[model samples]
Each structure stands twice: as C-alpha cells, then as structure tokens.
Target: MITLHHCPQTRSMRTLWLLNELGVPFQLRTYPFDRTLRSPAFLNLSPAGRVPALEIDGARMFETGAITEYLCERFSPDGLGTRPGSPNRMQWLVWVHFSETLSQHTAALTQQHVALREDHMRSPIVMKLEAARLGKCYAALEARLATPDENREYLLSSGFSAADISVGQAVYMSRHFATLDDFPATADWYARITARDSFAASLPNDDGIYDRDFYAPWPLE
Candidate 1:
C-alpha cells in the first residue's frame, strides 16, 4: 500500500480526506509539525520542506495539488476522472487547478492577517489588500453557486468527483481565517461534503488529527 507521511492540521489532512473518500487502502506515517520537515528523510522526499509528501511504489511525490491529481488519474474508480474526449473534462480540469489557484493562496494570505500573533502579523494595510483578493475569489464561487441550475448540487459532474473533493477541501480550509457568511454557497457546498459518509469516517479530532487506526475500528469500505 502507498504511504502518506503527514503532520496534523496541515495540508496533509486534505490528502487524507481524499484517500478516505476513495476508500483506498494505504499506510499513514504521522509526524509532528516542527523541524521534522527539515530531516534528511523528509528533505530527500521533498526538497521544498513540506508535509503531505507521498510515497508509492518506491517513488515519492509532493504538493497536494499534484498529488491529488496523480492519485485520481492513477487510482480512482472508473468514471471518476476527467477522461479524454469528455466534453465536461476540460471544465473539470480547470476547476481542479482552480481549487488551489482560486482559494488557497487567498486563504493563506488572510491567515497571515488574522492567525499570526499581534507582533507577527503584517500591517493592517497589507491585511486589507489580502482581504480584497479573498473577497474576489469568494465572489466568483458565489456567482457559480447562485447562477441557477436544476441540477446544481455538485460543483461538477452529475455526481461527486475528485474535482468536487478538491474544491470542497479548499473551501473547508477557508474557515480557519475567514467567515463563510461572505461565501454562503461555497460554505454550503463544503458542509454538504463533510456530511458525506466517507468524510464522516475521516473527520479529524478537535486537534485536527486523524489516527489511521481509527478507521480500522470498523472495516474500511
């Protein structure tokens, strides 16, 4: 089985959530959120020094966006991918990339404004500038969700897909530093995803940690 080396409350959790959703068998290697990223083992795995690095079949991969895309292409069940020649495939492809481009950067910028200690955060003027970018991203999502479609439940496809999972996880991260009130439709989309049977199985504790063995308490799907 593939092994995911990760630390809690970090981007690694998103990959964990994706694995759970797919009901794939894998091993989990947990690490603390400190200098472990600088260790020789981790450094050799990911020179960028980040958690959520993945090891599979003797090969290593880094970056949540890249990892998720590769997993979906290589491991997902049939019909779960943005297959070639499918008209909606391009749409899904764009949304998959947009999951990070449209949401994560803005969210992380806002984190600097609100999450850091008083002495650590930058000036209020900088915070306002970051907040503006975040607002624009939220506006795009709200428009999509509100644009009216009889079949508007999922972000793409007739049912759930990896694209939805990517977008959902990104939206879920926004809560750490911003309010969903500003992004009601996006908030509802993420809430609906977490309520899934698969997501409930992978839900982390208040400390934002998920024990792999915890899933073993009951047979995996």
Candidate 2:
C-alpha cells in the first residue's frame, strides 16, 4: 500500500489532493509543520526532511512534481495524466510543474508570516515582495484561463487532470498571501476546481500552519 507523509496547508497537501482524486487506498501519516521533520526517522524517509515523503512499492520518493507524475503514470495515466505522444502532453507537463513556481513564493510568505513567531523576526519587505510575486503567478493563471477561443474551465484543453490539482492547491496556499480579487478568471477557476469532492477530502480537519484564512502583508512604516 502507498503511504503519504503530509502536513496540512503545505505542498504535501497537493499530493494528498492528487491521491484523493486517484481514489487509491493509501495510508496517511500527518505531522506538524515543525522540526519534527528533522527527526532521524523522518529524515530517513526524506533526506531533505520534507513533508511529502512517499513510500510506494518499497521505494521512497520526494518532490511533489515527481510524485505526481509517477502516481498518475502508474495508476491513472489517461484520467489524471497526459501520457507521452498525447496532444496535451507538453501543456500537461508545463502546468503540472508550474505549480512549484507559485508555491516557492508562498513558501517564502509562509516563512515570513506563519513561521516567524515574533514580529521583529519577520521582514516586511519579504512579505510584500513575496505576496506581489504570488499576484504575478495569479496573473499568469488568469491569462491562461481567459483564453479567447476556449472555454477553459480547467488548466488543460483535454479536461481536468493532475495539472489542475497541482496548481489549484498552490493557489490555495497562495491565497493567504495574495487575494484573487483582480484575477477574475483565476478566482473563478479556483472556485470551480476546489468545489470538487476530491479537493474537499484533502483538506485538514484540524488547525494548520496558518491560523487565519488570510495573512495580509505587513504595513510599511
């Protein structure tokens, strides 16, 4: 059986969402978003001590994108993945991995807003800059979803796939730092995809890294 080591409201949630959509029976091992990841036992699962360490077929895997590709290819290639030689293959790969681009900025903002305990420990500039960068990522999604000739409800032309799950979850994290107000298409797409039962199943039942729904940028002096 597959096992996923996860933390709520982190990149690992992306993997959880994918697993839910795949409908595979798997065990979930959740941990707090803290130094527990540094424990030797956890480190053995993920050398870098990340939340999304996967145990499958007696092998270990890290990196959200790699795990997404492997799982989809192995279990639901046609449903959640666009295999090689398929028409949407290139676009599929692009959007599936592009989630990291958005997530990197969210990780930065998370560190600034959630990870730092004291106000003095946080950098206002970093908060503002990372939040702005998340807006830029939102803008990119807005453009993609607003394609003139297409009614693009999902990321791919073919239909919903892991690419949506990947990027949608990134947007979920990004929303705390940046609002989707200006990006109408992105907001709509986000709402549409997140409405899925699979997305709902992936959500945390308890408190997560962020205490609030939104984390506004620190005000300048």
Candidate 3:
C-alpha cells in the first residue's frame, strides 16, 4: 500500500489532491506543521524533513514534484499524466513543475506571516516583495489561460490533469496571502479547477498552519 506523510495545507496537499483525483486507495499519515517533522524518525523518511515524503513500493520518496511525476507515470499515464511522445507532454511537465515557482513565494510569505511569532520579527519589505512576486505569478497564469488563439478552461488545452492539481493547490495556499481579484482569467481558472471534489477532499479539516482565511500584508499600508 502507498503511504503519504502529510501535513495539512502544505505541498503534501498537492499529492493528496492527486491521489484523490486518481481514486486510488492509500494511507494518510498526518503531522502538525512543526518541529515534529524534524524528529529522527521523520528525518529518515525525508532527509529535509518536509511534509511531502511518500512511501511506495517499500521505498521512501521525498520532493513533491518527483512524487507527482512518479505517481502519474505509474498509475495514470494517459489520464492525469501525459506520457512521452504525447503532444501535451512538454506542456504537462512545464506546468506541473511550475507550481513550485508559485509555491516558493507562498513559502516565503507563510514564513513572514505565519511562522514569525512577534510582529517585529516580520519584515514589511519581505511581505511586500513576496506579495508582489505572487502577483507576477498570477499574471503569468492569466496570460497563459487567456491566450489569443484558444480559450483554456484549464492549464492544458487537452483537459484537466495533474498540472491543474499541482498549481491549483499552490494557488490555494497563495490565496491566503494574495487575492485573485486582479487577474480575472486566472481567478476563473482557479475557481474552475478548485471546484473539483478532489481538491475539496484535500482541504484542511481542522488544523492548519494559518489561523485565519487571509493574512494581510504587514503595516496595513
């Protein structure tokens, strides 16, 4: 049986969403987003002590992107995955990995807003810059979704795939820090993809890193 070591609202949710979409049976081991991840047992599962450590086929795997590719190729090559030689394969890989680009900024903002305990510990400059960076990421998605030649309801012209699940979850985490109102196309696409039952299933039940739905930029401008 496949086992996913996850923390709610982290990159692990990406895998969880994918698994739900795949409709495959698996075990979920959840941990709080804290020092427990640094324990010796957890470190052995993920050397970096990250939330997305996956155990499959009697071996452990870390890194969200690697786990995504492996799971798609193993179980859903023609469905959630675009196999080699398929026309959409390149686009598939690009968008699938592009989630990390968006996620990196969210990670920074999460550190600034949620990780830092005291107000003085958070830097306004960092908060402003990271929020701006998320806007840039949203702009890129807006451009892609609103291409002149085609109207893409999802990231890929082919249809919904793991790419949407990956980026959509990133957007899920990002929305807490940045609103999608400015980029209409991206917002619509986000709404379309997030409406999926799979995405719904992956949502945080009770515990999460953020205490509130939205965390405004520091200093209130």
Candidate 4:
C-alpha cells in the first residue's frame, strides 16, 4: 500500500489533495509542523527532512514536485495528469509545477510571520516583499483564468486536474499572507476549486501551522 508522510498545512497538503482526488486507497501519516520531522527515522524517509516523504513500491521519495509527477503518472495519467502527447500536456506541466513559484514566496512569508517566535527576529520588509510577490503570483493566475476568448473554470482547458490541487493548496497557504480580493478571476477560480469535496477532505482537522486565518503584513501598511 502507498504511504504518505504529511504535515497539515505545508506543501504536503498538495500531495494529500491529489491523493484524495485520485481516489486511491493509501495510508496517511500526519505529523506536526515541528522538529519531529528532523528525527533519524524521518530523515531516512526524506533525506532533506521535509514533509511529503512517500513510501511506495518499497522506494522512498522526497520533493513535492517529484512526488506529484510520480503519483499522477502512476495513478491518474489521463485524469489528474496528462500523459505524453496529450493536448493539454504542456499546459498541465506548466501549471502543475508553477505551484512552487507561489509556494516559495509563501515559505518566506511564513518564516517571517509564523516561524519566527520573537518580533525582533522578523523582517517587516521581507514580509511586505514576499506578500507582494504572492500578489504577482495571483495576478498571473488571474490573467491565465481570464485569457481572451476562453472561459477557464480551471487552470487547464481540459477541466479540473492535479494542477488545480497543486496551485490551490499553495493559494490556501498564501491566503493567510495575501488576500485574493483584487484578482477577481483568480479569486473566483480559487473559490470554485476549493469547494470540491477532495479539497475539503485535504484540510486540517484542527490547528495547522498557522494559528489564525490571516496574518497582516508587518508595520500594518
């Protein structure tokens, strides 16, 4: 059986959401977003000591993007994934991986707002800049969704796929740092995709990495 090592609100949720959408029976090992991930046993699962370490077919896998590609290709190639030569393959690959772009900035903002225990340890400038970067990411999604002549209910023209889950999970983390109010198309798309039962299933049952729904930028601009 496939086993997924996950943290509630981190990138691991991307894999979890995909797993839910794939409809495959698998074991989920949930961990707190803390030092337990650095334990020797966990490190053996993921050399880098990160969430989303996967054990499948007796092999261990690290890296969210790699895991995502492997799972989609293995379990849902034509559904949650696009196989080679498929019409939406290129777009599928583009949007699927683009989630990392947004996630990177979210990581920075998270470090500034959540990871740092003392106020003096955080950088307001970094918070503002990273949050702004998330806005740019949101704008990119807005433009893609509002592409001329085509009405996109999801990222790919084909329909909902893992790409939505990938990016949507990133957006889920990002929303705490940045709001989607300005990007109407992206906002609408986020709302539509997040309404899915799969997305709902992937949510944290209790507290997650963040203690609150939103964290305002430092200095309160």
TM-score of each: 0.82, 0.97, 0.98, 0.97
| lDDT (C-alpha) at residue 46 in model 2 | 93
lDDT of 4 by residue, 123-213 (tens): 9889989999999999999999999899989999989998999999999999999999999999999999999999999999885888888
- lDDT scores for all predictions? 0.67, 0.92, 0.93, 0.92
Query: What's the CA error at residue 160 for candidate 3, in Å?
Result: 0.2
Ranking by lDDT: 3, 2, 4, 1
Query: How well is each residue in 30-104 modelled by candidate 1, as lDDT tens digits?
Result: 877668889897999889888689999999999887888788888773445666676767767777677776455
Which consecutive 10 residues in model 3 have the weakest lDDT in total?
212-221
> In candidate 2, residue 179 scores what lDDT?
96
Q: Which model, 1 or 3, shows the larger TM-score?
A: 3
- Candidate 1, residue 15: Cα displacement in angstroms equals 1.2
Cα-lDDT of candidate 4: 0.92
How well does model 1 score by local distance difference test? 0.67
lDDT string, candidate 2, 62-135, tens digits: 99999999999999999899889999999999999999999999999888887777888989888988999998
Error of 3 at 209 (Å): 0.8
In candidate 2, which residue pairs get closer than 3 Å at backbone N, Cα or C atoms, i.e. clash? none
lDDT of 3 by residue, 1-221 (tens): 89999999999999999999999999999999889999999999999989799999899999999999999999999999999999999999999999999999999999988888888898999999999999999998999999989988999889999999999999999999899999999999998988889989999888988888888886742
